[model samples]
Target: MSHKQALIIYNPLSGKRKKHSAFPILLNKLSEIGYHLTVNEINEVNNMNNPIRKACTQKWDAIFIAGGDGTVNQTIQFLAEEEFRPNIGVFPFGTSNEFAKFMRVPNNIIDVVSVIESGCITPVDLGKFGNRYFINIAAAGWLADITYETPPFLKSKFGELAYCLYFFKKLLFKKPSDNISINISDTVFSDLSLFLIMNGNSVGPLERLIDEKICDDGYFHLLTYKKTTRIKLLFHLFAKLLNLSKDLSIIQHTKINEADFMLPESISLNLDGELASVNSSYFQVLPQHLNVFGSNKNN
Candidate 1:
């Protein structure tokens, strides 16, 4: 069999322990699996974009990204425009590697490489926010902006806990938002506090949002929180996150192909753990848009 060629696009700033992590082991494993690896650290975001643009110009059996959700989203944004998209494998080194986790990519770096070498290329759906394409999840409203608001130092210091702590603190001081409205075709959601559009299953720490398999479905999932008191929203959200809020069902969720939003005021969109500033925009799913190198997802 011919040897495979792989390109690993990494953003070192995506995680704190990345340098000390099992990254080298994974690279060694890739080499042993009869593959040639081209490793590149992103010195600048724009600098990396050009190489990715050029990557599709050649033949790469697989592309590994050593970053978190935002990096994945940025990569997808570029690949979506290309006529060819290689099977994507991720190191999940970013703050909220929700998409990677949902795909059941092993947290152990060695195991992650094994999954990629297993050659399970699963084609999955993609989401579009206005003109930008996102590989994982996107959201707007109250809790969505937390990552953007939290300081990088705090995130580096506290890791995932920082997000939870910051969210709790922000809820206490921030003013309640005005009732927002969303309309997708004939479907309408009014007095909403949060809007989430997902091409994958998990969102931050909330993985059980969908009990059904998510990927390869050719539809994006939508979750909107109803207008409610701050305490109640917090209680319900925490409960849901902990799998204790089944009876309380605080969200209105569905699988949709596309939707249009109408917001009374502007709330920045969070695209895969990064901020996307948009007051209102059309959202849609690009069915089976990209091939991913991971196990298939079950809802």
Candidate 2:
């Protein structure tokens, strides 16, 4: 078969300076591998989706994104809605490229490019919230509020540490509100503190905190927490910090293909890494919605 044409969508702000410098070398290696490559930088808001849609119209074989989870989410949203969906690839340039971890893509630029040119494809499930798409995790309540309140500068300097710092800050001041209700696979639960819907095993490379969650399982692992004492909350936080999911008594995990949340107050929702405030939200799993290009043997 002829080598597939690839469109690379990248976020220039992702990663450190050293990783950014290696982009040219990666492009050169891809060119030598008999694949036609087109690269575009995601500079402004909503810039990533336009090029991907245009590439689909041009009949490209695959769309390779070289950013963090948020960029990958944007690309998937476009592909999932398009008439012709192309294969996908992730270069893992962002701070926490969780999808890349699921696909087993190496952080090294050369290895990532080689994996893409190898022409392997895996059909992966995607989670949809309203009109957008997320491939890693969707969270709401206190966690989402903290994510939105965290400063960009802190994230740039400390990466995942920003999340940790913000988590403590929110927990100290924010009271657990029982204003939310969740319906998962027809089972309904009311008066919840927080809810995390995961497409992957872990949220990021923070394996110690997020646990070992798999992405290709065709269903979402939903974790919900009820209002509890401060001491219990502290213990649960420590358990997550140590990757001890079983010890965290405050958390409840269930698997479902679809879920909806009704909240009395406006709650912030984090889809992948992007944050938005919504009063109510619905999430559904779209199995095999994306064709991912990577080095996994099963694919």
Largest TM-score belongs to which candidate? Answer: 1
lDDT of each: 0.75, 0.72
For model 2, residues 158-243, the per-residue Cα lDDT tens digits are 87687788888877887765556888767888767778788665555455244445556679788777667766765785576566
Enumerate clash totals for all models, in the order shown: 4, 1
Best by lDDT: 1
Candidate 1, TM-score vs. the true structure? 0.89
Clash count in backbone of candidate 1? 4
Q: lDDT at 23 for candidate 1?
A: 75
Per residue, candidate 1 scores C-alpha lDDT tens digits across 1-299 of: 46787878787777566443667777888898877888777654454356666667785777788887777877776778888777889887877678788677877788887887778788888888788787777777777788778877776777788888998788878755667677777978888888778766567776666776677677878877887888888777667667676653457778888888776555667788887765348887888888887865553
lDDT of residue 193 for candidate 1: 86
Which segments of model 2 are wrong by more than 4 Å?
1-3, 44-49, 206-213, 240-249, 277-280, 295-299
RMSD of 1: 2.6
